[model samples]
Target: MTNSTLAQLLDPAITPRLVVKVGSALLVGKDGEPRREWLTALVAELAAARARGQDVIVVSSGAIALGARRLGLAKGGRGSLADAQAAAAVGQIALAGLWAELLAGHGLTAAQVLLTLDDLEERRRWLNVTATLGTLLARGAVPVINENDTVATEEIRFGDNDRLAARVGQAAGASAVLLLSDIDGLYDRDPRLPGATRIPVVRRVTPEIRAMATGGSSSGLGSGGMTSKLQAAEIAGLAGMALAIIDGQPVAPVGEALASGRGTLFMARPRKGARKAWLGGKLRVRGSVHVDEGAAAALARGSSLLAAGVTRVEGSFVRGDAVSVVGPGGDVLGRGLCEYDAGECARLIGRHSREHEEILGYAPRSALVHRDQLVLI
Candidate 1:
């Protein structure tokens, strides 16, 4: 946490892959119309970055706002979930058209991608998204992504696009994520108050730094505030991706912010692999497998956790869910995506891989927690 320059984060050579997020408030005006001029300028910058051989992805949030206007839903008024979904369905078309038209004007193809939280949380779906984004970039098309609000429920929805943008960056193996917002960057206190100063670089999201990210979104069109941005930064940081927050109200915002070093940059942690980082930083653990000392030592030696080494299984979890690997003395060692469900893991406990079929009626993956997926905390 210091006030210093980090303009290099925007360099294509340094950060070849970048994900930029534009909030609904920044993209849609009070009249519920797309801010065409502002978006055109942003698209021009993104096109230039792509022309420079940088993979640029835009995660824009404004479908619901635009849709709500078309549906005659009053601003700031509580609408039924069905009404919101319908609005999103209608708004997506207009949003996509606007992006396609603008990007085409710059001789760049635009790809519309809609995602739900499950799409990123589920392993197979996550891999599919990564592959799709990779293919799009390879084909020279910029992906304009948004959460699938129409199909997303409260349980499966990302409440804010900020966190969704961070996850998108992690899934795409991006080097950096830029959050274009209403504010310049994080401050020590409310910017409205005297003596409040923007902190330039955040090395970590500590409690003190979290305290500084107070206040809700100033624009009523968006749900994310400074707190959401900090949470997004933490997500990007853990995934070995730097995240920058800058005011997007200006023309050529990303370029201006970078040239002046006017935003807060959250430095990334050194990542062994994207999957390892994802495993290590999961917010919740679905279950845990307790292993013996030999298993713990084997894990430390970079070996997989075998079913035979597991002493106990706790909690109900499905395959691919994040599960904790516990040591004999009740110490939680690490976490990984489990290869089998909790019931199957329970039955396989203290059993060798060779005995897996006899116990479970089928032989599955040999390792309960593969070394590649496991990340020691």
Candidate 2:
């Protein structure tokens, strides 16, 4: 699709939710200070988005850069992990202050939220984060989110804000994610190459598309490269969220990019409900329940999976664990949280729902997997 066409499709007035990610390179100058003029223009765009009734969330990076400068550390390279952590400790204050000051000038409130990878990985923590963000947006506050760099170790770190923005978009149930970077968009070859060309729109991120990705961030101050952004695109795609990669150096970059679609737009798949998204993207399948043809047909009709339909259960799993639902022909149908353990499922296979209580010594639920917890692939 052409950029202009894509822009028409993603009219801000209709799209209610947006997540904008700004990299360190765009937010911080070579002197290790916030780029005030650029930020002021960006805030104006954010205000305009808010005026159109769009709930905007920002995933911003620049703490380390600012901190390194204040601490008199080397400018270009990420120092030791400890050094980076210290820099983050100091820079985060300056980062938050800059956002607060700039946003307040436009009559907008800024809320600082620091998150680690574990916040998204743990189900309870994830729910809390989502709830907090929702509450903030409901009250007309712009959330300025960043990785909790000071406390994060290598094992728990997201490493780049590209993937972090995608996760934030998914968690916030955003309609789209906008990654503002130094480059304009995805290129067919090395952008510096004479014959290289930009891809305006990506309908699907296939293996071939991934192969086009190159390593290393375009700007020396940032961590994510094109490869990480592509990875982020895949994550957002699976959650049925659109994403755009656009140049951030232009004046009123966010508004201009959306107005002209001057970037690479990744079209979202059909949107799914929150439960379905969690089932499809977050869970680890621990077992499989093979069903007969009749049961598979019933499932297609939106019926729950009863024990009578199950022919066999494979693997060990506890109740409430995610499991695969398979068809008689060995095709995978979907996934759901299993109501029964493996042994219990084995005993109840081919038995009617009425007999579940007698067979299992407890009448927990009629369906082995409730339709509410199931998500068809």
Which pairs of residues clash in candidate 2, taking residues 3 or more apart in a chain or in different chains?
none
The TM-score measured for candidate 2 stands at: 0.76
lDDT of 2 at 145: 99
Taken over the whole model, the C-alpha lDDT of each candidate is 0.86, 0.85
RMSD of each: 4.8, 5.3
**Residue range 42-76, candidate 2, lDDT tens digits:** 98888877777788899999999999998888853
* Candidate number of the best TM-score: 1
Question: Candidate 1, which segments miss by more than 4 Å at Cα?
Answer: 1-4, 76-78, 281-320, 323-335, 338-372
The lDDT, on a scale of 0 to 1, for candidate 1 is: 0.86
Candidate 1 matches the true fold with a TM-score of 0.80
Candidate 2 lDDT at 215 equals 94
What TM-scores do the predictions have?
A: 0.80, 0.76
Residue 146 C-alpha lDDT in model 2: 99
How much is 88 displaced in model 1, in angstroms? 0.7
